[model samples]
Target: MPAALRITLTTQEHQTLKELEVAECVPRRTKQRATALRLNAKGGKVKAIADYLGWAQSTVRQTIHRWNHHGLAGLWEAKGRGRKPSWTSQDWEALEQWLQEPRSISSRQLSQRWAKQRQVFVGAEQVRRILKKKWRWKRFRKKPPVPKNPELKAAKKRDLQTLKLWAQEDLITLLYLDESGCCSESPLYYGYSPIGQQKSISQRSRKGRRVNIMGVWEQDNRFEYTLKVGTYNANSYLRFMEWQAQKAMKRLFETGKPTVIIHSGRFNPSCQGS
Candidate 1:
């Protein structure tokens, strides 16, 4: 068996102990537990009190030491731990304002500006975090426009509305017909470029010419017909429409009457100089 030791608390210290035990705040609970163990028969050894209270001996000893040194206020949470913050709250506010300005500044440029204005040197990652958390900034990429022409915008909107109406009415005979040209010898541009050398150079295959492709889509199904004619004008477009109309008539004759929607490039009467 180990030697037994007795511990006793002064009247004033005992009163302080009781006050902590009944205190409503959470911080007081830790202090109370420490005090209670110290006043017990184990003789207030740092390790003994810490073991009884299920805390680190250092922590138990520190609490008593702090209480003795600085009184109750020292038991409160500290302002911060480790090294002090290099940037003040005011510095963060200024950084946020600078970011909000309409200036195309890169991360490096922004970091330099922050270091100059706030007198605090920070890395790109730290700046990014502060911007995101405080200013709600995020990384974003630009998207290309789907339709560049104003007239095409109106036309596409009209086409979509027409298709939606046809679908809602259960019109199975509706079709979307249009034509596009593809150059067989056209070279492909795989990547994107912001600026600099190589401008106005056409990337097209040397041997092949552009081929016009007339296509139609209906209810998620598509049909395409290609024209091998040398030069295409208004006459060729009408002729293509006529051929499609004849095919539609033949199909209707075999089956029943079906709603046929015909769409084409704008028609010009003077294409053949008629």
Candidate 2:
């Protein structure tokens, strides 16, 4: 066999290798290289060091060669040493522009669009990786509703605040009234199940009659609600309001404050008599 490759380390180089060999933060391969260099400096042969470290003999030789040429820098990898990304900055810019559209796009659709636009086919997995890692984008279930007239919404909010201040001073009793309806057949969409099993629920009927609720809430945490089997028409709502008004009159006399009812939805002129 040819003479065993031997390298002599300077005092600084030896100390650096000693520290790197024991360092916890460095990569395993870097630590291994440091250890191999230290051993070689102590007159350990290539094959012997390779056997002790469980590395191929050629790998040890390459490490020694790199250390000889590049010194401490050879212990870690250099940048741009692996496969390059296929997408460029221009491609990402185009993707950003595409994302500005009013609708959502899935990774599969994005990949297809990219292939169509650039003639470079990329998989959905790759597109997802780019979106998550490069763009730092996430998918959401729903977007919040935006008002048609923002200025009008702001004006209404300011009016509500003014009413709230009046209510706080006992100048008025502010009551919020609303109506909602829900079907009994609405099924629960989510539940937990044992691993690898599906969750399910049994129901006698898949469809059921709608239950309508008309409720009023006072600023003082008071609540009154009336339930109906079907919908609440103008006549039924007027009757409910009359009942609430009669109940409010008793408290109005005791508190000596005028009651102001606030309804956010459409109001029928027929209910004005109540």
Top model by TM-score, which number?
Answer: 2
Candidate 1 vs. true structure, TM-score: 0.32
Best by lDDT: 2
Model 1: per-residue Cα lDDT over 24-48, one tens digit each: 4445455655464455533566667
RMSD of 2: 11.5
lDDT of 1 at 141: 34
Q: Give per-residue CA lDDT, model 2, range 130-208, as digits (tens).
A: 6654343433223224324788878988999999999898798899988776876543333222233343333222245
TM-score for all predictions? Answer: 0.32, 0.45
Runs with alpha carbons beyond 4 Å of true place in candidate 1: 1-60, 63-90, 101-110, 116-118, 124-163, 166-217, 223-274
What is the C-alpha local distance difference test score of each model? 0.58, 0.75
User: What are the C-alpha RMSDs, in order, of all predicted structures?
Assistant: 15.2, 11.5
Model 1 per-residue lDDT at 180: 57
lDDT of 1: 0.58
